[model samples]
Target: MTRLGRIIQRFQSDQGGAALVEVAITVPLVLLLSAGVFEFSNILNTRLLLSAGVEDAARYMARCSDSTWNNCVALGKNLAVNGAVTGGSARVTGWTTAEITVGKTSTAAVDGSGTQLYLSSTGTVDVVQVSTALPYSGVVFWDFLGFGTIDITASHQERVVGW
Candidate 1:
């Protein structure tokens, strides 16, 4: 066979692990992305729940002027139990220097402000923080290839929404 033909024959007879090489390079990257996506989705779900919980707490407080801080906390906890909010911790606090308060409107107006039992606002800030640690099992190929679980910590504050 001619040199070119001989080269072609050699090429045809020899096998190259090109696919494995490509996969080795691409698989980890894909897995990393998959892990990130999963973690982000989990964080988003947690945020949605926290937001709803805080909103519910504020709503309850706005309506129930006679309600105490404990009462608002209970409202938030109960709302969370409905499964609208999942993962992380939740609590309600009111009237802190670190927080902004709008006194009740219907209730006796808080001095210095005309607002009473209407809707007092408090900055939930870190007071209502939810933290979730998620473990992403990674992509199917990555996990099978030896990649381990990805750990993610998602945290956020829930603001008090009055009225």
Candidate 2:
């Protein structure tokens, strides 16, 4: 047999190189998938935490507000901060400052349509809303995903029962 023919035969029979090539191709894909899952999970978890904080703030305002709404916004923001810091602590991890906005708005003003759903300028104020914006650039793959700093916003509203 010719030398080239023998070499060709050996190459065709070789299974070892095939496994190496397959691994080289598949390993990166596997790694990328794992990273994507981790990032997505982190995003979802953060959002849930923020949402819970907003809910707590809105509920408190709804039940507690009276003739005086003084510092009510501050109260809600503080409560939300506590929830964010405590709930997000996977082990001493917390944000020092989160963009939190708490305010009173009329049901009609936010009657389901507006750019700032939690805001009210006029009319009978009967709704308490807690809104928050968090910068989610801390995710492990956030940079890899090309999202410099995704701003995640969460808001919750509750009707003021007494006034």
Candidate 3:
């Protein structure tokens, strides 16, 4: 073969380390994809847990008298931790007694309300609002993605059923 033709043929025949190079390029991508999936799943799980906890507490306290409000808050914290537990870790570590807010309101904004504690209303028609503010950090892959801490809040309102 001529010089240029020989060079081209030799280059095409040199397949050494090609598989290694390909693997090197794809491994990181696969790892990143897997980490992202794990992170997203954790976040979704925590969100659902928070929602359930808030709703449960609100419903439970809705039927009780005002004297039992502390019980409602305590129950809310427990429910929140139970709901958020995964892989032996509580996703919402900020779920504490001080973070739980129990209040009475006259509006339907209970579901979308912030963590702020509204004044307790003594009226029979008032709705009890239970809310918690959770700090979310990705469990598996958050550091790899350079994501910062996220604050998620869950709130629910249930109308009083008894005096």
Query: Best candidate per TM-score, number?
Result: 2
> For each candidate, what is the lDDT?
0.46, 0.71, 0.69
lDDT of 3 by residue, 47-136 (tens): 887887788677767765557666655665555555422223453555665777888756532235453334344322467788987788
lDDT by residue for model 1 (1-163), tens = 6999988887786658778889999998997878777756754664455455445544554444444755555444454334322344433221111221222323222434544422345312112443333444544544665767754343334333342
Cα error, residue 113 of model 1, in Å, equals 16
- Write the residue-wise lDDT of candidate 2 on 37-65 in tens digits: 89888888888888887888788778774
Pairs that collide, model 3: none
Worst 10 residues of 2 by lDDT: 84-93
Candidate 2 TM-score, C-alpha based: 0.73
TM-score of each: 0.42, 0.73, 0.69
Best by lDDT: 2
